[model samples]
Target: MPLSEYEQRVLEQMERQLSSDDPKLVNTFQGRASSGLRRWVLVGLGAVVGLTVLVVGAATSNPIVGVLGFIVMFVSAVLAFSPPRRSGPTGVVGPDGTVRRPGTAPKPSRNQSFVQRMEARWERRRDERGR
Candidate 1:
């Protein structure tokens, strides 16, 4: 069923408020970082691997093999410390609270508090059926 004019206006106002409050929330939401202990442990492991590779490569007789080993070790170290990429909605949320993906219409603002919407729906249905 179509929304009444009042419902539509209320939704629009809620959308406007949410957009003004949090613009960053419109962008991709990044998850929290890993725990400090886990992060440090990974860093230590990377360091150890890097050092071992460097030492073994340097001790080797062949210069070419040593260079290759160094490159591999360097790449591994870089990958280990690299930050993870954000993986949430990259779309901007319009006036609505919904995240608007590219090429899609702005989502309808269903921003009424849950209780409010439910109560309104119940009232509307009751009135429609002459209850």
Candidate 2:
């Protein structure tokens, strides 16, 4: 079923708020897959170079060259498989364009175990939902 008018308005409002909050996140979600493809292309080139060096080293009698080639291959493989890191702060932006840092939740007591903290959080969520 289609959303009612009120629901549509709420969704539009949310979208506006989200765009205002962290535009980079919105852009990331909207971005094309070209960047990932470009990274893979670079990785492929590196791997090919590394493989060539490895072959050349093998043909010659250089152990150091072979080790260097292996290291290059390992680094290329890691870059190919690792996820890209995002730079910059993603803090909330106010209407006047001032960036407001997000507030962190209070940490649980130091004495509490991980499981106990998780359970307490779960209970709080459940209680909130009940109301």
Top-TM-score structure, candidate number = 2
- Residue pairs that clash (backbone atoms under 3 angstroms), model 1: none
TM-score of each: 0.35, 0.51
Q: How accurate is candidate 2 locally (lDDT)?
A: 0.81
Model 1, TM vs. native: 0.35
Query: Which residue pairs show backbone clashes in model 2?
Result: none
Q: Give a tens-digit lDDT track for model 2, residues 1-131.
A: 37799989999999999999999888887675577888899999899888888878888979888878888898999998899764456676644566666654455679999999999889877885695
> Candidate 1's residue-wise lDDT over 2-121, tens digit each?
899999999999877876787566332434445545666776676666666667767876666566656766765776678755466568775436676765754333887888877876
Error of 1 at 90 (Å): 1.7
Task: Flag regions of model 1 displaced more than 4 Å.
Answer: 1-32, 35-40, 76-83, 93-131
Predicted structure with the largest lDDT when compared to the true one: 2
